[model samples]
Target: MGVFYRAPEPGAKPFVAEGDLITRGQQVAIIEAMKLMIPVEADASGRVLEILVADGTPVEHGQPLLTVATGDADRAGPGR
Candidate 1:
């Protein structure tokens, strides 16, 4: 199974999705809500497999922002 990223708000403007693997510090996407620009982050170290949102599209909270295939997904604890 892969990890999925979800939007944090409902009917919010979508940001640009950078389908690039982010080891620790990387900008994945942005969420524009109430004229505020919020950056979405990648939570794990892996390759970015899919981006589920289009630029300027309205996104909902808990929506799948992207999917990542982390090699440590089967681990019992956080990735080291």
Candidate 2:
């Protein structure tokens, strides 16, 4: 949420794309609010499933930016 931006700037390549492997804390997108750019990072390491918003698109608070398919280790209990 908060005005999603897939790319750093106009005509620039996106930080990530569908099927791209992402790690936690890795910047996936940017959210601009009040002229400040806020990095949107991955909560968990995973493969990107989809990008829910376009570059420079305004987004709402709590709106999903993208879907990620985290590895089983993230979902399963330890010692399994």
Candidate 3:
């Protein structure tokens, strides 16, 4: 229900990247819909393995934006 909007500028560093370790509740990216910006956060702590979605792409609810190598499978949460 939203479009994935990453990085504030064309060459700005992304909030997170592959091989980057992130903790629970860390800001990952932003979703823009109706001109409002929504922040995406991590649900678990782990190393980011990959980014599943590209910037400026539309994403659905519960869509995974990235993958994390967490200790617990049930806790793996890179995005909603």
What CA root-mean-square deviation does each model show from the true structure? 8.3, 5.1, 2.2
Better of 1 and 3 by lDDT: 3
Which residue window of length 10 is worst by lDDT in model 1? 1-10
Prediction 3 TM-score vs. true: 0.85
Best by lDDT: 3
Q: Return the TM-score for each candidate structure.
A: 0.61, 0.86, 0.85
Compared with the true structure, all predictions reach lDDT values of: 0.54, 0.77, 0.82
Off by over 4 Å in 3: 72-79
The residue-by-residue lDDT of candidate 3 on 23-80, one tens digit each, is: 8888888888888888988888889898998988999988888888886744654444
| Pairs of colliding residues, candidate 1 | 9-61
What's the count of clashing pairs in each model shown? 1, 0, 0
lDDT of 1 by residue, 2-80 (tens): 2222434445543223454455345566667776777766566666676765555677766776666666643222111
Prediction 1 global C-alpha lDDT: 0.54
Q: Which parts of model 1 are misplaced by more than 4 Å?
A: 1-19, 73-80
Q: Which one is best on TM-score? A: 2
Q: Which ten residues in a row have the lowest lDDT in candidate 3?
A: 71-80
